[model samples]
Target: MNKDLEKLACKDLIDLALLMPKKFDDLRLNDAPILNELNCTKVVIKSKKQLAGKRLTCIAYSYNWECECTITIFNARPFHNALFAINKELLIYGKLNDFAGLLQFVNPKIIKNSGEITANYMIKGVSDKSISEIKKKYLNYESLKAYDLLDEHIKLLLTMSENSSDAMLLLNSDELNECLKFVEIFHHIRRLNETYKNDTLYKKLKTHDINKWLKSLPFSPTNDQLKAILDIKSDLENAKHKIRITMGDVGCGKSLVIFAAALMTYPNKAILMAPTSVLAQQLYEEAKRLMPGFVKILHFSGAKTKFMQDELQDANFVIGTHALLWADISDASLVMIDEQQRFGAKQRMRLKELATTNDVNPHYIEFSATPIPRTTALINSDIYSYSFIKELPFKKEIETKLITIEQSKELFNHIRIENEKNHQAIIVYPLIEEGKTNTYKPLESVIPYYEKHFKNVYYTHGKDKEKDNVLSEFALKGDVLLSTTIIEVGISLPRLSIIVIVAPERYGLSTLHQLRGRVGRNGVKSYCYLLSKNEFSDRLIEFSKTLDGFKIAEIDLANRKSGDLIDGDYQHGASFKYFDETSDNIILQKAKEYIHKLQDK
Candidate 1:
């Protein structure tokens, strides 16, 4: 703890010193600006012709030293409540600038005076009827020595606070203590994890054994697919408990990574959780079919009966949706999370807690076919443990097109004809409503676009409530399912060849990639149509055209102008906030470094 923190009354002085703005619930500014004492200066309000409308008061304080000051109290605005309700001294924020020959303050924070004194007083009867009482109670000290007491770091923070525009520049500085700590720690831990990961006993598990185990399968795993499986095996068998993230492009065999991890953890069962039951069901079915003989892979979904839950008892490996958290199973030794971000932090922790409560060491392997912003994911310490699969499955590619809904008909019919000839098509929509609404683009509203254009059409969305069952039924019966992002991850429709996304520009790059993942499952030539409005930028348009997730991530990062994308969303772990710095990078880096240094110790 810093020694100077004791002098501060508030417990959150670091945050206060940084002046990080919070949403205005009540107006109680603790530290507002103060003007030096004035000897014989008469200030005027000149912005408004009439003093009654709204005017800012500039009071020149010049007793011992000469310094100009302006005090602004909002009238007839939402902020005026402070003028009537607040009686405490305030440190007015905002610039003491000149307006029409008189100094003025604009949009100032009404800071409260707590255990401090200053000489500046509001003019008598200038705006308020109760000025005399407010002045009489606060007229004692000529100067408050608050600035002299600020530490060097606290002073730098205040300086940065005064100039909001230049705050980000300070963040990129390597010489700063925060950055130094962050960079050193991140590099050390990253290197350590890499070293430890390489030395695990599972690395010695020959790929031949894995290959022979899957030899009876109808298809062979791709080389990149094989490498991912090996990586999972290595992590699971490591000495330390594992929490690894496996991020790859769509259909790069992340599921195979889960299977391989499950295979490595012998005598211990695996728990895989998906966002939806359809995805979980698909994983359960596939894992059951591919595993070695006598391996029990049971599934538990919210849609399942008590009998089904009973069947999952004593199973070696279990797959399920959020429903598994309620299960009474004690055998799950490894937790496999697919589309990890879809399940929030609480949901993920609940699963981990289930394993811990049973006194069993459970390793976690998270899979994300859609690559999210890496920096954003790392902001939370809880979800930072991750690795990437940068390679693609094969040299095979998918042709992408950006067209309007009207133009999609011709392509939809052509794809339908192709589907009849051994190729299947999937049409993805962004909404479930009949008309335009807030936040979501309804598919029922977009159905008319392809109503007469194609035959045997189906639709699904999050608004459907029981969308998992609808998606399962649609996957089997409908030739073309016009769905929302509900089918983002883990659902495998093997025969599907084409994906048509309506309003693709509105969706995140990660989501668009996942939607495209629905196709290209069987390694046949696949196509994804992005039907977007003209509002999309050229770069975003180009991004939608590629099947490469890593490329898209790079482009997204390059296009992001610093503080965008990841800053506002609900973080994966603890709600990470910037305390003394503008970016949470320093705190995150320091936390990671501390963890690594402790590991070394």
Candidate 2:
């Protein structure tokens, strides 16, 4: 029997029993059962040593009979962390073994004082006991009814549930209950492996009116756009009431797909929401131009007047900013969201509230250029149905290259020649607006750059109200656009050929795709220059070497996961911070499981 382990209390004894090999009989009191397991000594491997000629040569040493088998090896120095220097007693657990006739203990676990185990120490080693440690901290669960433990914010809003479905006001409880009921009902009614017969007007265009629209268009919808449209259409048709989420590359014509759907669902009210006023206005004008029947569009933004909000209520296909959320939407049936992930879960839940009433819930179609990490988890959990449009629209090849300051000079010379040949170019930097104590390049105040490089150069940033107007002019009449990433979406001009992004490594993959998207609208041979000055620029350069947007996206998503803002951007309203994907998922799963067990209790 291990003497050191005898000192452990009942709780620690149980922990040891749970962790040790089953071959070791359970510890019993007063001559109860068989007990052969010893408190084994922990030996840390100082360095990789070959077992040669009946001996293992190393600084490492193992105790013949020490309990609590925990040993830590430090990578910094040989023999480092192998043993306590001050002869501090440790409870070690391991089996003695002979390797090449030399004694060793291959695996060991430690039972030590809680205070001695720092957070950093616990994280460094991988052991079977990790599960127990994790269950102990970071999780405090109790039993309550599913309805009882609902977040307080949700509960407070639920009380006024009568107006829950009204987008203008936050949801009250009745509205939330109504939405929950509808979701439950829809979940029951949802069909599997279903596809809708293109009965909508958008489907009509595909068969009859599409050619006309296609013929009228100077540029065709990229194959990617068509696929996305079809995927969204299928989701709309298959679900009991369409509930589909679609993701695509930036400038992938997501709005066009929405417009086509709206056209097909005409005479039926469709309400589209954009996160920002600028995006909302852009969507509204584009939808109206495409559908063209006195569209009766009302835009509700923070900037809208009371009169605007009042009139917006009756619009058939009202589109606008969050202000649209304030408009009464009792009659609006079809709900669509652009940049859906930008809003928090609470905001999105509000949208769901607006789309439902006590009796009926509107079908929802969510659009995102950047797919939230939760999308996959949701799909895995059978929470949401999904479809993807992964293909690009055109075959015209665009060369994407990463350039440094020196490389950018040569690229600039080439761009200059292209500009002289009547083509336009865009040079993008990270900072859209000038700052007081700035570190990033000022894309807006680049007068010195303009004078040094080109005959005529224009700048546009997010802060500028004339951003769209300026970008349009630059694409049409100007020789060069020395600008920021604001032109990543929706703006189209065929003559604008080259996009040179400064400090490309600072931008997300989605942002880069959008920037590249700005010029490829016309299927012309476009060029994208990725510029950076950081160590990470090597990765950006490697990414630029590939023209495949999806491939770049995959790499970017992986790299972004390692950043501080990774979880901050997604999981809106989620109180928990994520340290790692696997850890977070396991924690959530365990929490949910605990809740379920409590309910069972």
The digit string of per-residue lDDT tens for model 1 on 62-107 reads 2222344445554545445444232323344444455665445565
> Per-prediction TM-score, please?
0.65, 0.58
Best by lDDT: 1
Query: What residue runs in model 1 are displaced by over 4 Å at the alpha carbon?
Result: 1-220, 308-310, 358-360, 374-376, 379-387, 390-393, 405-422, 435-441, 445-451, 463-478, 553-569, 572-601
Q: Candidate 2 on 53-154: residue-level lDDT in tens?
A: 333233344343322222323232433334434344444444444455444444334544321212211322443244334323322222112223334323
lDDT of 2: 0.53
For model 2, what is the alpha-carbon lDDT of residue 426?
85
> CA lDDT, every prediction?
0.56, 0.53
TM-score of 1: 0.65
lDDT of 1 at 528: 83
Model 1 is weakest, by summed lDDT over 10 consecutive residues, at 37-46
